[model samples]
Target chain A: MRTLKFLLQKEFKQIFRSKSIIFSIVFAPIIQLILMPLAANYEVKNIYVAFVDHDHSSYSQKLINRVYSSIYFKAAPYSASYDDAMHLIEQNKADIIVEIPQGFEDNLVRESHDKLYLAVNAINGTKAGVGSGYLGSIIRDFNQDIQLQWKQPGHFAEAQTIDVVTNNWYNPYMSYFLFMVPGLMVSLLTGIGAFSASLNIVREKEIGTIEQINVTPIRKYHFLLGKLIPYWCLGMIVFTIGMLVSRLIYGIVPVGSIPLLYGFLAVYLLTLLGAGLLISTYSDTQQQAVSVAFFFVLIFNFISGIFTPIDSMPEWAKVLAYISPISHFAQVMRMVVLKGSGWSDVLPHLGAVFALGVVLNTWAVLNYRKTT
Target chain B: MAAITLDNIVKTYGEKDQKVLAVDQASFAVEEGEMFGLIGPDGAGKTTIFRILTTLLLPDSGTASVAGYDTAADYTQIRNCVGYMPGRFSLYQDLTVEENLKFFATIFNTTIEENYHLIKDIYVQIEPFKDRRAGKLSGGMKQKLALCCALIHKPTVLFLDEPTTGVDVVSRVEFWDMLKRLKAQGITILVSTPYMDEAVLCDRIALIQSGKILSVDTPANTVKKYPTKLYAAKASDMHQLLKDIRSYPGVASCFTFGESLHFTFRQDDAQNIAGLKATLDSGNYLDLVINEIQPNIEDYFIQISEPVHA
Candidate 1:
C-alpha cells in the first residue's frame, strides 16, 4: 500500500506538471462538450431539391406545390430538362431531384395512373433514405386529396370512428444532440484515460528513468496500481465536467440518480486505465504506445454507437459492439440520463465493464517485468 | 563470510537455435562488506548479472543467494534487503528531487529522515534543487539524486550498474568518494563499470568478457600476474616504427598506444636495445626511443584476452 501511494504521488506530480496534460485534462472536455453538440446533429432538415417537370399543366403545378409545402424539401429553380437537374445533383447544389413525364397530369386524370421518378444521392445513405421516405409521404397525401376532391360532388360519405395516439418514450422531441452528447462524452473520457496513462509509463521507459524504478524494492503490482489510480481519478473528473456541460449547454440532465451514473463511470474508467496499463507493459517506447492507443480508441468509438444507433447497424457488427466497454458504458449513460433507469436497467453494462477491467488489469500486472 | 554467491549461474535468452548466452555458466562470490566490481565493455553481460542478483531476472540454471536468502525462493526478502541502481537513470523524472527521494524511501517502508545519515554525503550536494524537476537536472546532479534514492533505505547490499557512464570527470570522482564512504558502513557493494580505471577503486575486481568471467582478484594482484616483458618504443615516424617492430623476429605482440608502440617480447630472446636500434635505423626511422613500461589493468586485460596457442 505504501508503495502504491508513492507511485501514485509520482505519477500525479508528473501529469500535473506538464502544461499539455493540464490543458488536455481540464479544457478538452469543455471544448468538446460545447462544439460536439452543435456539429453532430443527426436530424436532416432543409434538404435542397430540384424538379424536372415535362408536364406544364395546372395538375403538375399542384404536385410541385405539395412538395414545396412540406418543410423537408426546399425547392430550387425548376430545371428545363433532365440534364439540367442531373448537373445540379453532380455539382452538389441539390440532394434529390424529381422528374415528371410529359403527359403525367393527363395520364393521372384519364388513365388514373402515373409514376413519378425520384433520384437521390446515397453517399450519406441514412440522410438520403430519410429524405426519400419524406418525399413518398408527401406524394401520398397529395394523391389522397385528389381522390377526395373527385369523389365528393353530391354524395353523402360514410363516417367511420377511429382512435389514434402516439407517445415518444425517452426523448419526446427526438433531439439528436441530447442523445449523442452523453455517448460522445464516454468516448472522450476513455481516450484521455488510456492514452495518457500509457504515454506516461512509456515515456519513462524511453528516457531511461524506468531503469531507476526497476531497481527499487517496490513490488510490480504496486507500481502498476500507482500509475492506474491517478488516471482513473482524472477520468472521473473529466466525466463530471462532461455532465455539467451537458446540463448547461444542451439542457440535458440525468433522469436517474447522479450517484448511480458516477458509480458506473468509475468502473468504466478502470477498464480504460487497465487497457492503458496493458499497452504500457507491451510497448517499449512512447511512440508505440500512442499509435496503438490511437488504433484502439478509433475502433472502439466507431463501434460504440457514438455516431449512429446500434440498432441500425448490421447484426454481426452489433455482436462486435457487445464486447466493447465503450458500447456498454455509452448505453448505460444514455439509459440513466434519458430513460431514468434503475440498477436493473444498468446491471448488465456494469457487470461487463467490471469483468473486463479485472481481466485487463490482471494481464497488465502479469506482463509487467520488474527487471528489464 | 559470503554476502552474495552465484553457483554456475547461466542466463540464455530465446530458444535453441536463436539463443544468446547473455550470462554464461559463471560463478563468483563477494565477501561481506567488500566492494566488488565487474569490469567489462558493453554487451559483456554486466547488466545481465546485476539483474539476476537484484532478483529482477532469474538465472536459467543455477543457485544464487543474497544475504543468505535464495534469489528465487525468497525474492521478496531479497528485494527488501538490497538496493539496486540500474544501468539507466530510471527514476520518476517528472517528480522533484525531494519528491523522488521521499518516494523511494516510502517504497521501503521507511522515511528519508530516518536514514538521513546513509544518504547525507550525496544528497547534501543536490539538496538545494530539492524542488526542481528531476528531468531538468544536470547529468551530474541527476546521478547524485539517483544515488541518494538508492541509498535511502540503507540496505545490507547495494548493486550499481555503470553508475558513472556518461557523467563528467568531477562527478565521477565525487561518486566514487561517496561509494567509499558507504562501504565504511559495513554494507556489501557490487558495482559494474566498463571503465578500467575504476577497477583500482574496488577492493576486488572481476574482468568479464562475452558473458564470461576472465579473472577475479584484487587490482594489484591482477596486474602483478601479467607475465610478459612489455616495452614502449617510438620514432619520428611512429606508424612505420610499429610496422618495423612487428616484422622483427622476436616480437611477441605490438600495438600502438598514444605516441608510442607498446610491444611485448620473449624473455629469452637474444635481441637487445642494439638489435632493435639496428632494425629501426635500417628502416630509416627518426628520433628512435625505447623504454621499459609497467602494465596497467588494460594491458593485463589485453594479455589475457589474446588467443592462446597450444
Candidate 2:
C-alpha cells in the first residue's frame, strides 16, 4: 500500500508539472464541442439551382419565381440550353437543374399535365435525395394550385392519400449538437486516458527510470495500479468538464441522474486506462506506444456510433460494434442524456464495459514485468 | 556469513539455435559488509549478474540468495532489503529532486526523515535545488540524487550497476568516497564497472568476461598472480619497435600499453633482454629504453582472457 501511494504521488507530480496536460484537458474539450457540430450538419440549405426554360412564357417564369422564393433553392439564371445547365452543374456552381419543354404551358392547359425533367447530382447521396424531395413537393403544390384555379376546389378532396405523421420522440428539432456533444465527450476522454497514461509509462522507459523502479521492492500489480489510478482520475475530471460544456454551450443536459452518468463514465475510463497499460507493456518506445494508441482510438471512434447511428450500419458491422467499449459507452451517453434512462436501462452496457475493463486490466498486470 | 551467494548460476537469452549465454555457469560469493566489484568491459554480462542478484531478472538455472533470502521464492523480501542503482540514471526527470527522493523513500514504507543520516552527506549538496526538475540538473547532481534515492530506505545491501559510467571525474571520485562512507555503516555493497582503476577501491574484485568469471580475489592478489616478467620498452619509432619485439625469438606476448610496448618472454633468461635490444638495434630502432614495471589489474585481465595453450 505504501509503495502504491508513492507511485501514485510520483505519477501525479509528473502529470501536473507538464503544461501539455492542462492544454489537453481544458482546451481540447472546448474546441471539440464548438467546432464539431457546425462541421457535421446533414441538413442542406441555400442550394444553388439553375434551369433551361425553352418555354419562355409567363407560365415558365412564374414556376421559376416559385423555386427562387423557397429557402432550400437559389435560382441562378443562365442560357436556356441543356449544355449551359450541364456546364454549371459540372463546375459545382449549381446543385440541381430544371428543364421545361417549349409547349409546356399549352400542353398543361389543354392536356391538364405536362412532364418536366429534374437533374440532381447524386455524389452526396443523402443530400441529393433530400433536394429531390424538396423539388417534388414544390411541383406538386404548383399543380394543386393550377387545378384549384381552373376546376372546382372539391375536385382534389375526392383524391385518396395516406396521411402519415412522424412524432420525433427525444430530440424533436433533431439538432445535430444534441447528438454530437456526448459522443465527443467520449472521444475526449479516450484521448486523455489512452494517450496520456501510456505516454507516462513509455516516457519512463525511454529515460531509463523504469529500471530504477524495477529494482525496488514495489510489487508489479501495485506499481501498475498506482500508475493507472491517477490517470483514471484525470479521465473523470475531463469527462465532467465535457459534460459541463455540453450543458452550457449546446443546452444539452443529461436527462438521467448525473451520478449514474458519472458511474458509467468511471467504468469506461478504467477500460481505456487498462488499454493504455496494455499498450505500454507491449511497446518499448514512446513513439510506438503513441501510434498503437492512436490506431485503437481511431478504430474505436469510427465504429462506435460516434458520428453515425449504429442501426443504419449493416448487421455484421453492428456485431463488431458490440465488442467496442466506446460503442457501448457512446450508446449509454446518448441514452442517459437524450432518453432519461436509469441504471436498468444501462446495466447491460455497463456489464460489457466492466467485463472488458477487468479482462484488459488483468492482462496488463500479468504482462507487466519488472525486468526486461 | 555471505552477503550474497550464487550456486552455479546460468542465464541465457533467446532460443537454443541463436542463444546468447549472458551469464554462464558462474559462481562466487561476497562476504557480509564487503565492497565487492565485478569488473569487465561491455557485453561481459556484469549487468546481467547484477540484475539476477537484485531480483529484477530470474536466472534460468541457479540457487542464489541475497541477504539470506532465495531470489525466486523470496523475491519480495530480497527487494525490500536491497538498494539498486541501475546502469543508467533512471530517476523521474520531470519531478523535483525533493519529490524524487520522497517518492523512493515512501516506496519502502519509510520516510526521508527516518533515514536522513544515511543519505545526508550526499543529498546535502543538491538540497538547494530540491524544487528544480531533475531533467535540468547537471550530470553530477543527477548522480547524487539517484544515489540518495537508492539509499533512502537504508537497505542491508546496495547494488550499484556501473553508477559512475558517464559522470565527470570529480563526481566519480565523490561517488566513490560516498560509497566508502556507506560501507563504513556496515552495508554490503556490490558494484560493477568496466574501469579497471576502480578495482582497487573494492575489498575484493571479480574479473568477468563473456559471462564468465575469470578471476575473483583481492586486487593486490589478482595483479600479483601475473606469472611472467613484464618489461615496458619504447623506441624513437615506437610503432616499429612493437613489431620488431613481437618477431623476437623468445617473446611470449607483446601488446602496446600507452607510449610503451609491454612484452613478456617464454623464459626469464637474462640474456633475452640484451638479445631483443640487439634485434631492435639491427632493425634501425633508435633511443631504445626498457624498464621493468609492476602489472596492474588490466594487465592481469588481459593475461587471463587470452586463449590458453594445451
Candidate 3:
C-alpha cells in the first residue's frame, strides 16, 4: 500500500510536469467537445436545387419559390433546358435538379395529374437521401395547396382523411446537437482514458525505468494500480470539463442524478483504462501502443453508434457493437441526461462495464510479469 | 553460503532456427561481502548474467540463486534482497533525483531515513542538486544518482552492469573508490565492466567472451597464468613491425597494443627471443626497441582470448 502511494505520487508528478501530457489531459477533450458537434453535423442544410421549367406557367414559378423558401434548400441559377441543369449537377454547383414537364398547370388543372423529374447527385449518399426526401415533401405540400383551392374543406372530410402529427419525444426540437453531445462526451472520455494510459506505460518501457521497478519488491498489482489510479483521476477531470462545456455551450443539463452519472463514469473509465494498460503490457514501444490504440479507437467510435445508429447496422455489426463499452456508455448518457432515467435504468450498463473492467485488468496483470 | 551463485545457467533468445545463445552454461559464485566483476566487451553476455541473477530474466536450463534464494522459484524474496542497476540508465529521467531515490526506497518498503547511512556517502554529493531532474544531470552525475538510488534500499547484494562505461576517467576512479567504501560496509557487490583496468580493482573477476567464461581469478593471478613470456616491441614502422613479428615461425601471436606490438613465443625460451631480434634486425628496422615487461589484465585477456593455437 505504501509502495502504491509512492508510485502514484511519482506518476502524477511526471504527468503534471510534461507539458504535452497536461495539454492532452486537461484541454484537448474540452476543445474537441466544443468543436466536434458543430462540425460533425448529420443535418444536411443549404442543399442547392437547380430547376428546369418548360411550362412557363405561374404554378411552376410558385413551386420553385416554395422549394427555395424552405430552410433546407438554396436556389441554384435557373436553367432553360434539362441539359443546362445537367451541367449544373456535373459542375457540382447543384445537389439536386427539379424539372417540370410542359403544360404542368394545364395538366394539373384539367387532368388533375402532372409528372416532375428529380435528378439528385447521389455522390454524398446521406446528403442526397435527405435532400431528395425534403424535396419530395415540399412537392407534396404544393399539390395539397392546389387541391384545397379546387375543393371545399368539408368535401375531403367526407372522404375520411387521416391527419398524422409527429412529436419528437426526447429531443423535442430535433436538435442534432442534443443527440450528439452525449455520445461525443463518451468518445472524448474514452480517448483521454485509453490513449494516455497506454502511452504513459509504454513511455516508461522506452525509457528503461520499468526495469528498475521490476527489480524491486513491488507487487504487480501495486505497480499496475499505481499506473491506473493517476490516469483514472485525469480521466475524471477531463470528463468534468466535457460536462461543463456541454452545459455552457449547448445548454444541456443532465436531468438524471449527476452523482449517478459519475458513478457510471467511474466504472467505465476503469474499464477503458484497463484496456489501455492491457495494450501497454503487450507492447514494448510507444509507437506500437499508439497504432494499436488508434485501431481500437477507430473501431469503437464507428461501431458504437457515436455517429450512426446501431439498429441500422447489420446483425453481425450490432453484436460487435454491444461488446464495446462505448455503446453502453453512450446509451446511458443519453438515457440519464435526456430521459431522466434512474439507477435501475443504467444498472445493466454499469454491470457490463464492471465485468469488462475485471476481465481487462486481470489480463493486464497476468501479462505484466515481473520476471520473464 | 554464497551471496550469489549461478550453476550451469543457460539462456537463449529468439526461436527455432535463429536461436542466439545469450549466456551459455555460465557458472560463477560471489562469496559474501566480496567485490566481484564480470569483465568483457559489449555483447559478451555480461548484461544477460546480471539480468538472470536480478530476477528480471529466467534461464532456460540449470539454476541460479541470490542471497540463498532461488532466482526462478523464490524471485520475490530475491527481488526484495537485491539491488540492480542495469546497463542502461533505468531511473525516471523526468523525476527529480530526490523523488527517484525516495520512490525506490519506498517500493523496497524502507525509508530513506532508515537507510540513510547506507547511501549517505554518495547521496551527500548529489543532495545539493536533488531538485534537478535526472535527465538534466551530466553523465557522471547521473551515474552517481543511479548508484545512490540503488543503495538507498540497503540490499544485501548489489548488481551493477557497466556502471562506468560512459563516465569520465576521473569519475570512473572515484566510482571505484566509492565501491571500495561500499565493500567496507559488508555489501556483496557484483559489477561488470568492459574496461580492463577496472578489472584489477575487483577482488576477483571472471573474464568472459562470446557467452563463455575464459578464466575467473584475481587480476594478478590471471596475469601470472599467461602461457608464455610476453614482449612489447616498437619501431619506426610499427605496422610493418607487427607483420614481421607475426611472420616469424617462433612467434605464437602478435597484437598491436597502443603504439607497440605485444607478442608471445610458441616456446618461452631465450633462444626464441634471440631469433625474433635477428629477424627484425635482418628486416632493417630502425629505432627498434623491445623489452620483457610485466603483464597486465589486458595482456592476459588478449592472450587467452586469441583464436590462434600455440
Candidate 4:
C-alpha cells in the first residue's frame, strides 16, 4: 500500500505536469460532452419536398396543406411542369416529389379510388426512407378522414371497440440528446481510461524507467494498481463532469441513483483500465500499445451500439455485444438514468461488469511478470 | 563473506536455430563491502549478468544470490536490499531530478531524507538543477542523477551496469569518486564498464568477452599475468611499423598501443630488445624506438582474450 501510494503520487504528478495530457484528461471530455451531443443528432428534419399537381381540386390542395404543415418536411413552390419538379430533384434541392392525377378529387368522389406518384431521393437513404414513410402515413390519415365523411348515418357498421394508444416511455418527445449523452460519456471515459493506462506503462517502457521499477521490491499488483488507479480516478472525474453537463446543459438528470451509477463505473473503469494494462504488458513500445488499444476501442464502441441499437443487430452480433463491457455500462446508464431503475434492475449488468473486472485485471497482473 | 554469488549461471534466448547464450556458465562472487567491476564491451553479456543479479532476469540454469538471499526463491529479500542502475538511464526523463530521486526513494519505503548522507556527494552536484527534466540534462548530469536515485534507497548492494558508458571523462571521474565514497559506506558496489581504463578503478574485475570471463583478478594481477616481457615500440612510419613487426617470424603477438606497437616474442626466439630492434630496423621501418614498459589493463585484455568459441 505504501508503494502504491508513492507510485500513484508520481503518476498523478506526471499526468498533471504535461500540458497535453492535462488537456486530454480534464478538458477534452468536457468539450466533447458539450458538443458531440449537439452535433450527433439522429432525428432528421426539414426534408425538402416539391409537388407536381395535375389536379387543381380542393383534395389536392388539402393534401398540399397537410404536407406543408408537418415539421418533417418543407414545401417547395409548385412546379409548372413535371420537368421543372424533376429539375428540383436533379439539383438536390428537393428530397421528395408528390404528383396527384388531374381527376384525383373526382376519382375519389365518383369511383372512390385514385393513384398518386412519389419520387423520393434515395441518396442519404435514412432521410429518404423516413421521409417517404412519414408522407405515406399522412396520406393514409387523409384517406381515413375521407372515408368517414363519405359514410351516411343510416349505413353505419359495427366496429371493434379496442382503443389503441402508444406512449414513448421515458423520452416522451424522443429527445436524441438524452439517450445519446449518457452513451457518449461511456465512450469518452473508456478512451481516456484505457489509453492513458496502457500508455503509462508503455511510456515507462519507452523511457526505460520500468526497468528501474521492475528491480524494486514493489509487487506486480502494486505496480499495476499504481499505474491504473490514477486513470481510474480520472475516469470517474470525467464521468462526473459528463453527468453534470448532461443535467445542466442538456437537462438529462438521472432518474436513478447517482451513487449507483458511480458504483458500476468503478467496476467498469477497472475492467477497461485492466485491459489497457494488459496491452501494455505485452507491448514493448508506446506506439504498439496505442495502436492495439485503438483497435480494441473501435470494436468495443461499435459492438456497444454507440451508433446503432444492439437489438436490431444480427443474432451473432447481438451475442457479441452482450459480452462487450460498455454494453453492460450502457445498459446500466440508460436503465438507471433514463428509466429510474433500482439496484435489482441493474444487478445482472453490475455482476457481469464485476466479473469482467476480476478476470481482466487478474490476467493483466499475471501477465506482468517481474522476471523476464 | 560474499555479498553476491553467481554459480554457473547460464541464460539463453530464442529458439532452435536462432538461440543465443547470453550468459554462459558465469560464476563469480563479490566480497562484502568490495568494489567489483564487470569489464566488457557491449554484447559481452554485462547487462545480462546485471539483470540476473538484480532479480530482473532468471538464469536458464544454476542459482544466484544477493545479500545472502536466493534470487529465485527469496527475490523479495534480494530486491529490498539491492539498488540497480541499468545499462540505460532508467529514470523518468519527464520528471525533474529531485522528483526522480524522491520517487525511487519512496518506492523502497524510505524518503530522500533518510539517505541524504549516502547520496549527498553525487546528489549535491546535480541538486542545483533539481527542477530540470532528466532528459534535458547533459549525459554527465544524467549519470549523476541515475546514481543518486540508485543510491537514495541506501541499498546494501548496488548494481551499476555501464554507468559511465556515455559520460564525459570529468563526470566519469566524479562518478567513480561517488562510488568510492559509497564503498566507504560499506555498500558492496558492482559496476560494469566497457572502457578498459575504468577497470583499474575496481578492486577486482572479471574480464568478460563474448558472454565468457577471460580473466578475473585485481587490475595489477591481470596486467602481471601478461606471460612474456612486453615492449612498446614506435617508428616514424607508424603504419608500416605495425605490419612489418607483426610479420617478423619471432613475434608472438603485436597490437597498436596508444601511438606505438606492443609486442612480445615467440617461445624459441631471441628475447633481447637489441636483437628484436635489429630485425624491425631491417624491415623498411624508420626511427625505430623500443622501450620495455609495464602493460596496462587494456594491453592485458587485448593480449589475454581469445574468441569464446575457439
Identify the candidate with maximal lDDT.
3
Fill in the DockQ of model 3: 0.91
Q: What is the TM-score of chain A alone in each candidate?
A: 0.91, 0.93, 0.97, 0.94
How well does chain B match by TM-score in each candidate? 0.95, 0.97, 0.97, 0.96
Q: Ranking by lDDT, best first?
A: 3, 2, 4, 1
lDDT of 3 by residue, B270-307 (tens): 99999889888988787999999888999998887777
| Overall local distance difference test of candidate 1 | 0.85
Query: What pairs collide in candidate 1?
Result: A209-B90, A209-B91, A212-B90
Q: Which stretches in model 2 have alpha-carbon errors above 4 Å?
A: A158-161, B15-17, B308-310
Q: What share of the true interface contacts does candidate 3 keep?
A: 1.00
Give the Å error, residue A355, model 2. 1.9
> Taking the tens digit of each residue's C-alpha lDDT, what string does model 1 give over B1-310?
6999988999999878999999888899999999999998899999999889988788999988999998888888888889888877777777789988998898788999999999988888899999998889999998888888888888999999999999999889989999999999999999999998999999999998888898999999999988977788978887778878888877778887767888888663546555876877777765778888888888888788766311
Could you tally the backbone clashes for each prediction?
Answer: 3, 0, 0, 0
Pitting candidate 2 against candidate 4, the one with the higher DockQ is 4
- Give the lowest summed-lDDT range of ten residues in model 3 chain A: A156-165
Superposed model 3: Cα runs more than 4 Å off: A152-154, A157-160, B308-310
True contacts kept of each: 0.81, 0.89, 1.00, 0.94
Q: Relative to the true structure, how large is the alpha-carbon lDDT of every model?
A: 0.85, 0.88, 0.90, 0.87
Better of 2 and 3 by TM-score: 3
Candidate 3 local lDDT, A113-151, one digit each (tens): 799999999999999999999999999889988877766
